[model samples]
Target: MTTIDTREAAVAGLALFPPSLRISALESKNFRDEVGLSVDAVIQLDEIGVAFRRSTLFKNIRALLSENVASAEIIDRNNQSWNIALDKEKHGIRITAAERTYLIPDFSCLHPNVDNRLAWFDAETKRHGVSDEDLRAWRRILADREIDDEEVDGLLKQFRLTPRYVSAAIEKSLRRKNIRIDALIPDEVTYFDRLVGKPAPEHDLKQFFEHTTKERPGLDLPAAFLLSSHSFGPQSIALEAVDPAKVLEFFDWAEHAGDRFTQVGVVECGLRHLHKMPQLAPHLRNIIQTIRSDDLTSETGRLELLCALIMLVDGELARTGICRERQPFWRRLAAIAHASVIERAIVAVNMLPDDFIAWCRQSRGLHFYLQTFVDMRREPRWSPDLLSASQLKAEFIGRIVAAAPENAGTMLGDGSLELFDRASSSSLVAQVSFPFSFLPGPLEGGQPSIATMPQEIEDNLNEMLRSETLTAKSFVTLVNSALLYPLDGEFARLAAEGLARAKYELPNIKSSDEAFHLLVGLAIVASVTRSAKLANEVKILMRAVRRKPDIEISQENAFRICLLAAPASAGLSDWGKYIGDCATELSFEDMSRDSITTLWNFIEVLRQLEPTLLQTTSRADAALQAAFACCPPEVKTAEAS
Candidate 1:
């Protein structure tokens, strides 16, 4: 036969089967690789055969091949007929059917095998041309026999199957051989090597880590770090079973390596496993060492790392049951850590249990408690279930007072008093009763000294008093500062000037809350110092309160106004009216413990100011009783004296 006739015979042979099978056969690695034909070349040949069959060209070619060769009819599983012709030497087979006729160009390459069949199914699936029948047929075939890992890996390399197919194939192979992940543990390095850079499915990686960790009992930190570096989710591993020594070793390497990504991953892993570990001291030390060794000022991420570690340690300590044993480590951390780090650490410890706070109060000195409260006031996100801001301030200040009652006045020099004033301003309704009595009392012979007052306080007071005219706010601030600091002549002088300015400004103050704060400050100053000028100013502010009777007031402010008015017989009726208004607005249903304490202090102050009023005014009596009902039993007992 001529070359044209032979080429025509090849075309007639390939068209005997369905297009899917024909495409698969041509694309098979066994066929294409042996023939040294590129996939594109095979695709081109298939397209030519398809074109030849669609036209009348293939029929003529098949007839010419048949005249020169002998043929036999074969049927496929679909019951499709195909005529097969063999050459004289039986080296080549010619296929002829009504659909088309083609030659099996080479029997050696086209021969069907398990690998080739799988490749065909994979190709069909990739092309989106595989039918349900074909899928079920291949599934049954894959299910019935065992596919070794070598063959599966070979198929994956030859034809990059989709993730779903890869997962199913791996799962099936694992089942057929009854292979456990533990069985592969010895060759894990080899397994990871083979699959790491390849398009290995996530399911395979997840399975490897899961089973390997289970079999090994502790994490292989280096291997996990490696995988995580390659974008694997390290969190998928159960880190609770990790060996602390291995974690330390990982940190040692991470510290020297200076690989930020790996360091962060290891830190996160440590955090996740911290609470689960039986002992945390070693891990805590290692983490703190890592934080200290790193220069946080060089990078923002390092600061974030410090914050994360603080959260981890603080959260662990907040678990009351576990904090006692861990207290020394936490205290050491606070002592030696950087100032910013300690500040963040203190902010996070706001949620510590009451016992922990008390222990801290007893074991730690005044400077520690003072710094903690100062740091807490600066933190915007500070919220603790155990204590509100006001309560925390009270607790800390109470500690300072108990430690050095005589030097409590010295806190004004240290800026603690100013912090107190700012805290009170921020959450006015939640104000706790500070022991102003701890401040220097009036001397029997002379005026108190202002030498210890903070420079900022002195500067602010001097600047305000020097102004041409003080606003109502300035006057109120002056009075509040006077109330918090020692009752020095300067403060009393500022208070006098503020009251003198308020005599004009109080009439124009429209907001009842604003007017009430002014009144409360003036009256408290008047009562404490027994200043006739301030007392007259308080009376004028009270009249302003009466003029704005239609103005609304919060229950807390109303109580303050009544507390201030209770001592004066001339203001007694106004005190009862204010209490009546408060009774209607007060609801202790969701009141915080600190808020309840504050309200109880108000009642106590009223009782001290005018004991008879509580019994005489029915509404005032009822309000006091309701407030007592809501007061925590300890609060009632503590303040009863």
Candidate 2:
């Protein structure tokens, strides 16, 4: 009906059509016109893949062209109508519009091979002014099925022209479905044929693991190990009950598995799980024993066994709802830490790298061992006599001191110096008080002998004093002749010097409380060494007791020492003075309830020791009256007096 410029007509025609139809029509335009058809005939061609004879195709094509609403016509160079042709035998179509003639082959002929027919159609659609994206959509249509008209209409509603857009969208949807369905098509025969050949690839474990990982990422290391070890199904709970032998086989496989760190992690995980199995303990123990005995013959085996032992002793395990009887883990540990065995364990520990050493040190069991070793010196020996017990304790302590890792001698006499230094640098003080050891039986004079302990007593004492941690009570205990055996004059002098140095080292001791307490204890020892005035100096230092000083313990301690140091020469007269001092310092207002009780006890001991003091100054009489009043009623009046 009308003629338009070639380029203008093509652009105008695309604009007249919906976007989806424009693209499809542009691709099939040459094919349609080659068979002398209008645009509607090309639209129908885009939907179905069926081919017809050229004569019949042309006749149908002309009917659609004659109804052209755009009123466009084919033209030549002279602006006249052009001839079109169709060769249905070859499925070839030729079109003449304006001065140009376009040849269009059937879609089947366009692709060189049937296998790539879709790809060729996609390429041609793109070349004929269809956008790259629309061409892909068209391919999807041809490839898919089960696409419905509603979905096509929904796609068309997004545009202005509904009718022209729906067909191509439906075709694209079908193509997509076809492609997917094709991929889903099974090769059952091929799969069975593969299985029929031989056994499967170790249950295809490696591939299955890879597939699982690719499908679901972020598995924990140990869990991944378990997964790779067995054909665990998709159900995690069900898979959890996998055969132990299969799991162990996976572990065995991992033993010689590649040198990947993952392999090691997996094997270690399996071993740890094995350790936790209650039923497997005996078996595992046997294996460990075997390894311990013979594994050392090979370096690698030894290392592995060592590593396994470390894990065995330390691993935290999950339970399978089973209860087990406890073993004597502590006794075993004691045997391990024994002098003979300890050296080997220590040497083994040292041979390991520093990180391993740190790990061992951090181990709960190993840390506990270190603490026990430090404390072993103080453990009491079963003594028949208090004196013998003391002797044995000292001897044991001496051996421990000898074991000190060098530099232990410096602070042994009085740990106060090191204590002061440590306190200045650190926030907390570590003080250990070792109990006294006395001979089991009394001497002819009923006095306990302090000397028979093992040589290790002094050595261990020195070791404790030399510790970076201070022993405040121990230092005072050793100094207090009232509390402990009086050291010889020479020993007393050395101790006094050591205490003096500690005072100087620990500047934090601003009050005479500590210094005076220490001095009083020192004086008591001096009195034991035959010096009375030193005991009196202790009295002067304690004058603060009357004023309710914070150093009441020091005062009480000083008084106790005075009683201990009072010359067997002072006899009863000395007791008068001691009783007077005790009366002055042990007032209820001046001391705590416990301290007052302790004061009463001291008077009792003094009364027991020197009954004549009661007669000389009536000190014993006064003490007895006080004890009778406060003592718990147990028919002990005779015992009191």
Candidate 3:
């Protein structure tokens, strides 16, 4: 395979990673020594295994591995299967799945949203109001002083601009205008842009700054740093706080400040404390309806107005603090949000696509929420929308939770799956509590024989097991046969404890399929160790196994007994017969061919080690025993308890 194909394969492999791996960091040595070494063999995409390379997906996967995302999906768009999402994690251009399960890309890394920064800049300007930060930043860059990373980060926070945005502004100012990039970018009021060279009737900007900074104790601004003597103030209005009693007075002066800056400043004050003044919501809504489209479209104005609108929308609006006020404005938002199709509803409106969806994230209103989006994507959602007024409540919550990793628990009623595709190791680990269930995959290495897997992941799994934090699903995923299995004894302990705990929890799990997985998990534990306690637990699962046998799981159970108890096998002989009974009862269609072959292999091996019990009289069965001639004399079966 070419470099491109190898990288693509590596990415697909990443899809199989556990939720923790998708949102956590991994040491290079651990990944290379452990996960890296084993990944190629189990890649869901055959091409990834054939053309796989370590270097291809490592760089981009590093970032995706560390941060949270709002949405991650394998989308077939424009004739390409691309992985896209609204990334909230750190910066990067592409995402590569280490599991190689699906071909996809991370959205933010696509075309760097730079150079084209102005596309959104114009819209952002109104929402933020015109600040002299750009002009101030340009002038500061000319200072020729050394600047470091902290200062650069400060520039982003202070400007509310992306790193990309700040970088571009700095490039334009310094490379084009001989300015220093280290100079501070302003977050201050932009009352000076229109006054670059004008004669105003208000007070002198310099004197006013000095007087305001000296007299107003609470308003102790730099006053001297970014202002020029030529700059002038609007009217004689002084800056004031957003007091509930002085609300009307504030707006009065804001409108008459002789410049748009004061007007925007008033809007900012209202936004900061809008939640406290619910009575004023109606008035604010009126104000929005009256603002010019251009002003409402600017970035600052748009964001501020949206903030105010968000505060007015009813019931646990996304991002903003909750607002239960179902006002007429919500209807307007709904109308703006309406569409017959989920994607079309969001795409139908321009200007506020994301904002509209974000606001109705928890709403039950039909137009505001749709069931289709949730059905389209498999992820975690926060709530049930108990009232059922909206169909997409689950999807709504999922989008937000996917964006915020801190809120993942809201969706994990059972540790079945996360929002994205995952690799076999992570997926298997996730199902660790269920035991013999993870059987039919291509994994051939069993404990003590396998070498690949990072120490960090092993340590992490061990820690989770020791702490009893590993979920039952994760437990079963960690304890598979052959190629995919954990060497950590803590995992075994956790699996034992989990099996014990499962007896009480089984009734709570309504799905028979899920319960069967738990039963299979017990059989696996019994096969791997000599603990009487675990053996007793296996009896509990065995008595509880109400469903017809899952052949693959049964095959795995037999294979494990042969692998662990053969050659001087003692306590496992009966369990081996038990496993054999389940395995032999399976019809071809009832199990995967691979599993049938595996069962045949294990039965032959066990017959060699314990010939008296397993030897067959049937000629066909004897013929099948030919393949076991080279079976290893020693197996890793545990000492009998």
Candidate 4:
């Protein structure tokens, strides 16, 4: 073969050979001569992992030892034939010319490990022949020249360049000069469009994305932009035509790439290709399941990417097939930002119901999920879908009361608490189980001692006791609210003890604001349970505190004391009479609608116990009827029997 023909064939074959390995050189040319084998025949017989190697150190040194050649002028350092060697005698494969010996892989040549393998290979192959700078220099000289095949072959043999390497060098040279992929991959942007039988204007990436199909595999978008995109961010590619297995690889790169711009490109590319590629669904689902804030470098960046991915995947999953299969993915994502109990309660309440119900079904998970659900309910704005997917069954309530009733107090306002009396067939709450209590008063083992409890539980109780406005965020208030639907007397007893504790602290309370706050919580529980001792203590404390004119009582305090008339109407007549007399003096104007509703609940609960007491207390009844009389009231029954 001619020099150009031989070099081209050798390069193509070497590119296909396993890296750092080559065909075995069984014997030297002395043996070949002894066997009378021709050079062409020897070359033909070596296709089975047996062939000439890289660099200039060939097994047959006789080929380069021709008497016509002299000096290093005949040597090409860039040649590949010398790099692959048997090293059978530990001297490595060697070529001797005159007084010099060339080794198949001199210790000077670096063999790259896997991590740096590609870059090392690219560098080694491009090092001696021509630098990238020379590649640019050559491109500039050849810019206006139209070379015939003979001239091109002549240039290849002269420069010792493979056509493929020359093409790559030319692309890199142009790409460095112009920061665009078009300068790198010279194939027309309309390649896919033409293949798919569509036509579009030049370099229209959107049209390319639209017309590109798997049946017509084309150039890789990432490969084309690898060198060009360093100036801008990473380039985004619509990946409908990408192999499905590569989708995950793309995401992995996006997640772990050190450059922020590169990561941004990956997210953008994945989003652009999202719905157009169904193969990405499983990966997206897995992300939803294992969503974590710490995976990304920046929290804000993570949130931005997460929101975009969710929005894209949400559109993709609104169906009844594989889409329906990803329901846990959807439900779990409502809490993607906050997966723990405290954060979930204050931040991800929407996801609570599903987790609560599902976890409650597991024998081992019962207390963990239930405790978390109710604890979160203690936070404000925590209205949920009433455990909509599961029924409020008797056993479920029984399991709760039996399992983690201390947390049940947190479930005070939930409709499922009503189910302390009832059951259902999806899950998530309706009923007044007046005979049941979520959290019974201080544990029967005695007043809850903080010393022995878990630090978290102690923290929760202390937090509950702290009141906002002596109204909201009150442990007593929330627990008192739960007291109204006591499934047992334990809740009332608990409130009574809390009231006693407040009464002990009453005389020392420096602020009038703090003076009578605990009275409201206690009075509510007293009215629910008709506890005389709690009522007497409230009345005595209120009367004594009023004597200290600076320690005036709140209107809510008076209102709650008065609302007690319903339960105390007959048996506790003296208590009802005292509150009825105090009612007309306090104003209801500053009361919040929520507080008002709570008061009305107390009054209504009383009315159910004894409506006549409210009627007899004309002043209290008149104020309530006056305020509510102007409202467009809904027609509703009082309560269940």
Candidate 5:
């Protein structure tokens, strides 16, 4: 055979070394003579692995070497040479007259002791010819506990085994010790990248996870590892291969056996991978249900779970696109964002750390905040801590203002005013007496009394009415001044007409501030003038405000507006019933002084308007009695009257 032919055979034979094996081993003249090939020929194959050696083409080259024939001649007569090919699989080593080629030696054929097996691994790893097959053989030999785990780890690191073999080693280690799989593998990008692609590593990962789950059951390590691997490490394709049923089973186990934090982490992982496995979409409700059912122990955990649920819903909405609101899932999500859940969420938002709050902001957690504000305002027993609920409302509105400052006026006016009107009216009447102080005394015919506006205020109102450049802010200020002093019939008509002009010019006044003012202005004018047109305008503006998220308007001005507007806007029939329902539903023992006072104001207003309209159930009466006990002597005396 020609030198080229002999060199080709040598190159093919040497292309099987693992990274731990030194290439310099082929440099020895004695080794070269023994192998019957040039060092250059062996150097060419250093990067190739044993899989290349097992190919049929490589086997044909081997047959040529065995026959002492040139590679060209063997290729020319492919059929005859293929038929003459030896079974290269029988042994990892082959010896011929021209060369001795080591493929992947069987270390088990030698002594089975720890020292001997380790020695074999060390020697093979140092030579220029170790292959992945050799690493596998070493793994099998070490699986018998012949070597210590430290030795296995050391060998794994020293030999630089491929991820597949490393995974095998990891699986074996897991079988012996409850150690993290990540601890066994190198934290190198290349190692993880290779691990992601290989089916053998994938299989080993699956087995290790299954073993860990079966043995430890509720340990978060497996879930954590999966999250890390799927999110930041080499995105494990094996995660997609994980059975949907298995994932569901894990969810079940996690729900019952895991802590709040672990359960949140599991759900987060599921959400992160939901796009890849849409089968998980249906189970999201159950996941949220699990979270909702959890004890209100860890505020941080509760916030985190809520954030995860928001992300899930956001993703679902984005995935489903424009028609999402019409779907059942949309309705379900709406239900999930219910008042009780929002109440807990509000508490969490109030108490959680700023970093978590920042995350919520970044993740659009304000959606939940808005939902809560809208839903809770309509509930009778809105919040146990009315003070906190009030603060949360301010915070929510503040965030909305901060997020879209330019649109604040229009958004708030159109969306928040009416909602705020209800709460503010309740709060204003319940807690303060100034708004109701305008009423005639109980001995003086029990009627609301109106007072003339001061000349200074009337002139300012006239100036505002005449000014063409009047803004919503200016309109609000003028109306507020008028309401504070009490509007006489003539001034109230002029103020109502001015409000009409402001509404016409500032048609886009959707701000909460503006809406609050406009609503009160309209109600005041409607009551003072007793005009159907002005009352209808109040209703129209109210309907517009109600179209947005709910807010409560509770201040002196709102009370004046409600008291003035109720008669002309129709009657306190609806308002009275709502207040009665709230009184019945309220847990007076849990209410604050301000909240109890607000409920009392609601009852007082109802009693003044149409006593029969305020239907009192026994529960409501008891609630009112309890509320009276918490009040000052003056309040109890007033209630007696």
Candidate 6:
């Protein structure tokens, strides 16, 4: 059993480090003499081994050899016996008379064979085994044989520089043979024996200081420094406890660091406590404003700054003590910064036309910003300005949409439509228009040709929708607006005709497929419009289209169009025929699996608006249940779990 030191045990917990860990600090002379002489022998063995053993070097090696050195006794500096024999068979070293042998690569050398020797020593030694500090010392000597070994030599001075010590020493003894080993050792071996340490990166003086946190009275601060005017307090009072020196130090590190990752770390550390320092709000505001567009685009810097901003704004609003008026300024600053990050990312996507689809497909770090924006807008202090967020989101979406059609190279992914749901649901466009009009920039009333100028507003909106960014409510609004456009008919036909002809490859052509879907959705809206001339005609056409079988279409597609035409507000009776067809298809175990899910969502939509539909789609519901039963137990469990 090993005895553990109270202090070391406290730091190490249950795990105890070996005694060798403190070898460098050990002041014992026996350890020093034995270790130094052994190290010298190893160095000699590295040189002319055969010649040294046969001549004067043999005598020097013998002078330092103790009875235990050549014996099986394995005791460390503590005088505890560690019964382990050195293996001369391993490395071609011979020990005469004593059965105990010394391995050429023993504790004194930096060699792989040392692991076994250390293990043996550890198993046999009592009290505790050698600590890492002792091993480190041995390694250092082995790493560079030329190092002036204090531990081993210091052992000799205290124990007496006797014939045993002198003879045991691998280097020649000046007193006995009047020979200097340094002169005898080759220059090549000496040069190669020196150790080279790893170089350190440049560090600044500002990093030297460390702050200690302690509770202070009356100031409401969590802590204070003995020599400083500044103190630590809650984040909302950040401005009051401002430490210009610490903040400046952080800024200096961020500005000077070559790696963006390091700079971002510094930026985060600097602003992490901002939520606790409301007094420092002005400085925090300045920092946010000073952050460049390039830095926001940087992989490292953006997330850090975003986290800091979120904490700052959210913390301030959460506190009941803060001034209500100050909330809007923080909210607006967060909003503008959030918007700017997305705007820059979208701009970057636009610049790459040929790779636009792939570019947009990549993660643009928008979710974090959008999430922060959503959370901030949810706070009671700023909820009334929900219009501000809606408008910001709308303008961003509109700009993206308007630009898409014009930029031939830039295309959207299937997922691009999703962003539209988010934007429209937030009513970002209307909100944005409250401050700035939704209309495109123009000189007077003359409208610019959509052909020449990029319609980024529309393009970005489409991109979001195709990406599935838009919610159902927002999608409905977009479809409704598109139908009201005088050119809705032409646009719908153009999109449908493109899909019909398979004008572009599905994977290569991104924007067109979504455009086709939007057009189809718009056509549905157009047919439902209650206008003077087309209302009756549109109803007649819907009925006619339902009954007529255009040979160009499949039964599957016809049913899908019917379901598409079925509004969320449509009653169960209205969707009975379409739901029946969907159930029948699902029953046949057809390849159109996705159609079943689509029908389910549509049915769900109607169920919410028309409860009667839930009763009407009984067969559809049963078939869905059966299909789900046919799935594997794991799948069922996954769904249930």
RMSD per prediction, one decimal? 28.9, 35.9, 27.3, 31.2, 29.0, 26.0
| Model 4 local distance difference test score | 0.35
Model 4 spans with C-alpha error above 4 angstroms: 1-506, 564-582, 585-614, 621-641
Residue-level lDDT of model 5, residues 116-138, one tens digit each, is 55555666554522344446665
Candidate 4 or 1, higher lDDT = 1
Q: Using TM-score, give the best candidate's number.
A: 1
Residue-pair clashes per prediction, in order, are: 7, 29, 66, 28, 19, 88
Candidate 1, after superposition: displacement of residue 218 in Å?
48
Compose the digit string of candidate 2's lDDT tens values, residues 202-272: 32323433444454323222234322111121222121355666555544443433212223233223334
lDDT of 6 by residue, 21-123 (tens): 5443234446445444222322243332322222233232332232234534322333333333345456333333235333443332212344543443343
| Shift in Å, residue 532, candidate 5 | 3.8
| RMSD in Å for model 3 | 27.3
Runs of candidate 1 with Cα error greater than 4 angstroms are: 1-387, 390-451, 454-470, 489-504, 507-512, 527-536, 549-551, 554-556, 564-641
Local error of candidate 2 at residue 393 (angstroms):
2.0
TM-score of 1: 0.24
* TM-score of each model, in listed order: 0.24, 0.22, 0.20, 0.21, 0.21, 0.22
Global lDDT scores for all candidate models: 0.40, 0.35, 0.33, 0.35, 0.40, 0.32
- Candidate order by decreasing TM-score: 1, 2, 6, 4, 5, 3
In model 3, the worst 10-residue window by lDDT is 373-382
